[model samples]
Target: MGKKFLKSDEEVVDPKATLEVSCKPKCVRQLKEYQACTKRIEGDESGHKHCTGQYFDYWHCIDKCTEVQMQSAACSIHCICGFSFALYSLYCMFLLIWSMERSDEEVVDPKATMEVYCKPKCVRQLKDYQACTRRIEGDESGSKHCTGQYFDYWQCIDKCVAPKLFEKLK
Candidate 1:
């Protein structure tokens, strides 16, 4: 008999089917292996002499081809460093000038240098004490220094050489 194709309502089907298939297993393993190997390859090889030589040679070629690019730019690293240093120097100079301009007399310290400077009004006020004493003595002796205009500072007769200037005005 010859093989005959049939159209039927019910077709041959497996009720309890057990099939095993491995598709592209070698490809999956190769992808994982390649990923693992290439992951650290760049970092590990970057420090190597051969890789650094190649890198430096590549940069050197690029630098030679673009000579102007390799030259100092307006915002180059060296220019920035030099500009910052100059700015710092100028700031320090300005600070020194400002400090020098400020007066040093206001600083508070007990151990600092002490010097005597004359003030005229304080000296005149101190001399008034002697004048008051002379006036008091001459008034008793009826001398010309006693014009009787002074009433002996409220008539208590206190000595001017002593500490008490006069009784408090009430």
Candidate 2:
């Protein structure tokens, strides 16, 4: 391989995107219907001609094929991972409560509860970050950035969350 200095900046492609492109061939019929609807309504000045039905039909077809593919694929590899994680966590919590794996004293979500405590302590840092954002709003030149301020705000939150986050996750 040739020496590539900017390899670290390479874009990450989601597996689900590839799956969707593969499933597109199965939905070509719906796709053509949508395309035909648009073509048939191309120059209608009366505004009566519309393709809402065909548009949704195509989307429905794509979603059905995507669902089938998702069932056969690893959910962790999907694009909607955050949503899946949230639902999974809620399910796990429900199961834990039913199985008596977690006691009443154990915090179900420590990071959220801790953030409430952490935020107030870091109000000054938060204000500094907010002020930096406001200052950057007027800078048309791309040289200005609020990265330091952004990091400062997040660093405060992370510090406050760190002490109890691992303990709660356990």
Q: Report RMSD (Å) for each prediction in the order shown.
A: 45.5, 19.8
Kindly give the stretch of ten consecutive residues in candidate 1 with the minimal lDDT sum. 15-24
User: What lDDT would each prediction earn against the true structure?
Assistant: 0.36, 0.67
For model 1, residues 1-170, the per-residue Cα lDDT tens digits are: 55567679767643212110111231343345445545534343223212333345334333332332223221253444456687655665555455445422233222111101222323444455457645554233323332232333312222332223222222
Worst ten-residue run, lDDT, model 2? 99-108
Candidate 2: Cα lDDT at 85 = 71
* Candidate with maximal lDDT: 2
Any residue pairs clashing in model 2, and if so which? none
Clashes of 2: 0
Over 1-170, each residue of candidate 2 has an lDDT whose tens digit, in order, gives 65455577788778667867866776777799999978865765555446787789777766766655555354333423345577775664455444343222222245656888899989989999889867865554546666688678879999989978887665
